[model samples]
Target: MTWETVPLRSVARVDAVHVAPEAISTSDVYVGLEHIGRNGAIDETYYPAAREIKSSKNRFDGRHILYGKLRPNLAKVARPRERGVCSTDIYPILPGSSVDRAYLAHFLLSPEAVGFAAARTAGVNLPRVSWSALGELPIPLPPLAEQRRIAAILDEADALRLTAICRLRLFQKLEESAFELVLSVSR
Candidate 1:
């Protein structure tokens, strides 16, 4: 089936709600670029209080897809689980009614979109993909049902990959213990 391609802006818009550092409550969660992982992984463990944030930040709800503008090649994107504030260097994008949020996040995390962002980024020390440039990215649109299905599959794959990684680490640790036991017995 042929999918209609449209500009990213047609499916999502950057939420521009900026909150001053002083305005943010001390208990508020703050997410910086460091808190976001490549390929839509989020480091939820790093929950810094708002008081730790020195600069102005953008407010985002769970519905927002946070995309890191700086160093776009790293593809720092995340779907936050709760309301929080993020660094100004990140854009909190909200999907349009026609688009599924998870689908949009996966699309943005795709290598194609990451390459497009990397090419469009400017600045030497702090290369970034501006909202205008990112908005112009071509998105392959499918029916809403298909979009959700694809997103679900991708999410499942991600979960499986994480499980595999954890298992590999556990095996490595077990091997190390076994080796140590063997060496001790020889002694």
Candidate 2:
């Protein structure tokens, strides 16, 4: 069955929820656009709001995905590995359980979807995504089973990419070691 493409505003409310600054006693989960990965992984570390929540900040279950509405091209988004909170800049997308987050996240990262965002982003000296246009953004859908498969494939590919990066780093370290050894011997 074909899933309907509803505006994000229809799927769930995308309003910003504020955290009082006085609530925090210690530094905790900090999230910002810098934490967002171009590949859609979010690393919540030292976010400004994290310093403000005493008991808890804006916590989100892994089921919900976060988006960076500030910059469209960044493709900054992620589904929390566990329940966690983030800064006010990140939008917590609380869709009904029927909506597959993995599916939604995958769709959000599509070049076509990001392209729409690029066309609509408006600003003067600093470019900011058009949040209203982003709200009404169209999302494509596939069967739930297909969505799961696609997510799995994506995860596997991501693992490989990370592995390749590690190998490249090791190779570079070896190259540096070899150069150092040559210099020492010559001395």
Candidate 3:
């Protein structure tokens, strides 16, 4: 299949719905850059209630793909599982009808995209990728079905990698325990 390359703005838009602190509900979940893990994962435990937030925040639903504009090299991205408010530092991207949220999220996490954002970041301290710059990023577009298939494959690979890392950590812990046991017995 021939994939067409287009600017990210052509396939998605940044939903800049900033809700004032007073308008935000206490029960609303709030995600900050720290709440997002590198490469499209969310640190579910870190989200705070909106009541604790003092500034205006962007509102997003599960359909939006959250991209951390600050420190884009970290590739902090995620598909929110529920409606929530996020730091203005994050761009809540809403994929166009032709685009798939998962596919778009994976693409944004790609090395090319991360490099693009990193290179374009502005500011001496706390550098950030502006919405205009992010919107200009080139994206490879495939057929909807192909995009879904590709996303599924990538998801499976990511899952396998995580499992392997978990297993490796468990083995390391076991080794440490065995070494301590041997030392204690010798003593």
- The number of the candidate with the highest lDDT is 1
Clashes of 3: 0
Candidate 1 residue lDDT tens string, 1-187: 8999999998899997999988988767788899887757778787777667788889999999999999989989999888889999999999999899999999999999999999999999999999999999999999999999999999999999989999999999999999999999999
lDDT of 3 by residue, 1-187 (tens): 5689999999999988989998888677788988887757777776566567889999999999999999899998999998889999999999999888899999999999999999999997899999899999999999999999999999999999899999999999999999999999999
The per-residue C-alpha lDDT of model 3 at residue 184 equals 100
Native-to-model Cα distance after best TM-score fit, residue 175 in candidate 2, in Å: 1.1
Q: Candidate 2: lDDT over CA atoms?
A: 0.68
Q: Which stretches of candidate 1 lie over 4 Å from their true place?
A: none
Give lDDT per model, in order. Answer: 0.91, 0.68, 0.91
Question: What local lDDT score does residue 148 receive in model 1, on the 0 to 100 scale?
Answer: 98
TM-score, structure 3 vs. true: 0.94
lDDT of 2 by residue, 125-144 (tens): 55566558887887655666
Listed in order, each prediction's TM-score against the native is 0.96, 0.80, 0.94
Off by over 4 Å in 3: none
Instruction: Return the number of clashes found in candidate 1.
Output: 0
Clashes of each: 0, 5, 0
Using lDDT as the measure, what is the rank order of every candidate, best first? 1, 3, 2
Ranking by TM-score: 1, 3, 2
